[model samples]
Target: MTASANLWTHTNTEAVDARPLDADASADLVIIGGGFTGCAAALEAARSGASVVLLEAQSVAHGGSGRNVGLVNAGLWLPPEEVVAIMGEAAGPLLIEALGRGPETVFALIRDHGIACEAVQNGTLHLAHAPSGFRDLEERYRQGNRFGAPLQLLDRAETARRTGSERFHGALLDPRAGTVQPRAYCTGLARAAAGLGAAIHEQSPVTRVARSNGAWQVEANGHRVRARRLLVATNAYHAGAEGAYRPQYVAVSYCQFATAPLTAAQRAMVLPGGEGCWDTALVMSSIRTDAAGRLIVGGMGNSEGAAGAIHAGWARRKLKALYPALADLPFEHHWRGRIAMTRDHIPKVVEFAPEAYAVFGYSGRGICPGTVLGTAAARALLGAGAEALPLPVLPAYAERFTTLLGGYYEFGAALSHAAAPRLPV
Candidate 1:
């Protein structure tokens, strides 16, 4: 099994290329990390007449943004009530309202920019793995409705009809959500930003960031970028010595497997509506089909870790269990990426200095929230004021026992996968 084989890389239609930065330059905003957030912010800031310089350590969408599940879902993994409780009454509702419009923001960008990312806006289904899961979905359905979301709870019969699998007890559908080729969407944003004179540089990893003489000076690949404002959007892939501050969050590993394009009959029977779905199990799993009719199944746990074989075996069993027709179909691609998960499962914006902000920790829902926050961050950083942001900018924030918590999650996922019932292919 080639651990680095990624479906998105193979099927990506959008492309972006750039040389590493080697000369001194300056801009109104300097963005680090060429993922969804950074690219989105670059596009927004540049379009708004602000000179932008985006420096990426690798190629665009090379991090979690490239390896995302592609589900353009609204809101966080936490329920609306949980988000409200965690964020409190005032800030919570604001965050929820902004995120609820996340899918809208994403799709509009695709439409306006003509990004060829196989954008699908049908909807997404939240499957209930058990009776308890159904209860949880019921609560989520209620909470979502109260927040003016057009959510629909489907019965088991309907769920089976829609998913073509009787494995789920029921499902909650969000009509606003959809799917996309994550890497394509990300690269498309970079391409669009670059076309608008954003000055995107690939392979330009930042070696140091400092406030020199009341201006932010970012050093990358032996080059310097002096800017009045700075935005550090490197979530889980923060590396090297970034002076002043670094993003703090627990790193959770998620892996995915994709089968070869299914036959027309098989594709018709499974997810014909092209709605992405995820289960309600404690160690949740996801299923969706791409434009080429390939089925993708993903779950928690790293595919390159010591328990790699266990995760591989569990994926095989899961594929067989979900769709017996493709029980013998081997996965054509296997890959993994790390997610920046905050303890409260909420994103953070740290204003570490007078005109510098670092945004990160999307928990697992990056597409929608990342777009929302990135756009808002651009607006705020370019004189729109911090009030334009979804969540209030904090002076500072920290998490304790991050390494221990990450290890705990990996151990629990491995144990669960190893204990799953074996099914004959």
Candidate 2:
């Protein structure tokens, strides 16, 4: 398979046909990046009667948005109290409450727009990889119940029945979460926004952004877009835009391998509830079946690097260990994407300038938080105050030793993947 080959891209039927910006244009808002955040913001702003122009470095959803695990989960990776501790007393619960409703926003958009992405709202599973992992889930269950989340703690037998695997010690099921064809979802958002009069330009990489004559001028594809407000939603795939604020976060790579569509019998024996799943290992891993019944296994390492073969080999072993019946099945699709992780594992909305913001650092939880933050950022840019947004807006946020930290994560993932086969499940 090619480097860019992804199961989502091949399976997606909803295509957003947009041209590159070929002429200077003016709008109320000009957005850089065309991932979920940018597309969601465009749709929201255009629906609110604002003139919006979205410029993409490549195609829509070409970044991490396209290469995600497709799990539309609620809230961040951190537990409720940890989030509250990191964000503060008032702001923490507010953000938590807002994100708790993120899946609703995402699913509503899919339903309202008639998006063709295979959106399954059957909920997601957080599997416990060991006895210690089960303890973590116990705490999470407690916290989730305190916050009124409809979460259930499943015993090992129930988890094995649902997942068709006896490797997990327990599982936490969150009914509010689900999955989607992430890339197709982003394309659908772009198409919906364009239908609402938003101008979305693909392959229009922004080279420079500056404030001039009381407007934000974004230069892209040899043309200029002058707008009253600007939003940088690039996340980890941000290239460079002069005078535009670049997000500072640790960039960790996540890679996935997908098998061919399983037979009906195979599908029936595996993930019968159609819920996406991830385990609570130190180096976490994920498993989910697509709408086409392809079993996708993902891990925390770059699949395009020297350790690619090792990770791929580990994935094969992992599949066999989890489901011995499918050991001979081969992966037909392989791809990798980067995640922008903040120190606190929380999403942020950075107020870079007046009427301008950069939202990113969803960690590995992009679908829900991206949609919520993107929509909130658009509302704020169009005159809604900070109170209207989900997360607290900061004047500036920075991370020190980002490259070192990113390297550390990569090294750890490589080591773990290499050592996985030696360790018994």
| Top-lDDT structure, candidate number | 2
Number of clashes recorded per candidate: 0, 0
**Model 1: per-residue lDDT, tens digit, 360-396?**
9999999998888998998999998899998989999
- In terms of TM-score, how similar is model 2 to the real structure? 0.99
The residue-by-residue lDDT of candidate 2 on 268-349, one tens digit each, is: 9999889999989989999999988999999999989878888888889899999999998988999999999999999889
RMSD after Cα superposition, model 1: 1.5
Q: Candidate 1: which pairs clash?
A: none
Per-model TM-score versus the true fold: 0.98, 0.99
lDDT of each: 0.92, 0.93
TM-score of 1: 0.98
What is the lDDT, from 0 to 100, of the residue 345 in candidate 1? 93
In model 2, which regions exceed 4 Å deviation?
1-4
- Per-residue lDDT, model 1, residue 29, is 96
